[model samples]
Target: MKQEVNELIDPSKFRDRIDIKGIEKSLLVDMLRKMVLIRKAEEKLSEHVESGKIKCPCHLGIGQEAIGVAVSLVMRKSDRAFGAHRSHSHFLALNENTYSLFAEVLGKYDGCSHGMGGSMHIVDNDNGFKGSVPIVGATIPIATGAGLAAKMDKAGDISISYFGDGACEEGVLHESLNMASIMNLPVLYVCENNLFASHLHIDLRQPSNSTSRFAKAHHINYNTVDGNDVVGMYKLLKSEVESMRSSNTPYYLEAFTYRWKGHVGHRDDIDVGVKRGAQLDSWKKRDPIKRLADSLIYEGVLTESEYQYLNHEIQNKINSDWEKAELASFPENEFLITQVYS
Candidate 1:
């Protein structure tokens, strides 16, 4: 299947640099760093999963890093962000603490979810990330409820729901969209449309590649974004996010991106059963981190050496964090009885 080729979802279609005109230097650098940190952390997870060090299944968003980073930067810390199964990026984008993630996956007591949730169930409420679950489309309605709560509180904070295109198949998503639209709730629905959801290419499941048609049905504003273009993504989502804050209405953003790693583990997922090898190589060309780094280097915002250094810096941090996470103690047998609530 020729996925995302020569289409609007294609990386060649979007040419704006992360260091584009009128953008702040610091913001660009920060976005780049966050994206790098997320990518490195996920890569480490992938390595461990392949080596059998991590027992928990991890979903790596290696190429789909831009959306989470851009959205995190655009949305305020007070805004509540909820994530779906593949939410390592969503969590790290806000907290940037891989130690918690590493610990959580390792089942250590100091994990973000106290080693109970593992990779799919991490939560960092202090950083505005409420939680992520393995259930598909579970948090859309929860985010909608948070949006309604935000409306009732009059606190000026919005709710963000991050899910993949596959979650669009769920009935609760439509209900959440309708409720948010009709009630004028301030919620931002983020769809990471990576063309393939869980080993099946989207063409087999979705009649039309775009999921924003549902937004039109609900009278909610919608936009399809180049999820790989971090700078462009920021400008587009930031405006919509700001507008949603004032209007108290819902906004839907569908980001077109691809995942370098397979659905579950570290491999391309072909030999394991998925027929994605044909298109996987091409999708790698549109890698989000590389695109942003190239643009930044081209625009002279940072040199190649600096970019390499940034990568090295993040990798070193990940290494240290992973070591610390490994040494952390696991919950004692009695701890389960104490922690489990009625």
Candidate 2:
């Protein structure tokens, strides 16, 4: 009959404002393009969902694109990565096909899951993306298995699992962390702590706001960084991933961020209820995309005109991909029973 209380961890204490020096201009531009592409793609998906074009439920990662893109930059094709419901950015960051994503969302035959799995169940093996699912902490063990396989095969590949802060509440995540740490599995647990699991904030649910305490419980080496700052995350992940690859050790990264949209759809304020109005507005001021672009322009790495042009190019690409997917065919009735048992 004993109840346990969870303490909230202050993420701002670990915030590191990393200098964006030593990064090439070309790479910076590419990062910007990736973020813009993700934003535009999600925007289009929102429109489609509103129009009844996409039947599947999507957990859009509108404000959390930079974390995936930065990590993807450091990951190799041999490494495996997995995501949860809010994972479009995870798939796209690894350079997954946009048309296939569109097709999948549309339930077309050309979807990444062949029209079988919708938004939450995307897979891209060619790009080292194992898969994404809706179940919280479901992929944690899978990622650990992958890391074990990579170790057994001596493939020099690590497994990365991206999950929400809510997922840390699951018992499986704790077990997976313990196993990875004890066995020295080459897995990186990237927790995208957007501060909410559906409508409830972390303070209301967890005792500690910092999820890294769980990592410490398992003796895992962990780093907490600003999820909005792509440059900082990229640098930190580069080092952490390198260590995992070299020592076959497990690493944990907690990214503090906020989602611009509602939990499952396009509406930003509808499902969020009354308490979120002011909090949401304040978070918007800490916008990742705008901050990064502003920093790049101020640092002379990118011009305002160039930034505008890049946005135009990314928007065009998203529009074109959506159009192509819209015209794509759905899976034939006869093919329904296929790919199930195999």
Best by TM-score: 1
TM-scores across all candidates?
Answer: 0.95, 0.93
Q: How many clashes in each structure?
A: 0, 10
lDDT of 2 by residue, 67-104 (tens): 99999999999999999999999999888478889889
TM-score of 2: 0.93
Whole-model Cα lDDT per candidate? 0.86, 0.85
TM-score of 1: 0.95
Q: Estimate, for each residue in 110-190, the C-alpha lDDT of model 1 and write its tens digit.
A: 999888889899899998999998899999999999999988888778999999989998899899999998899999999
* Top-lDDT candidate index: 1
Give the least accurate 10-residue stretch of model 1, judged by summed lDDT: 1-10
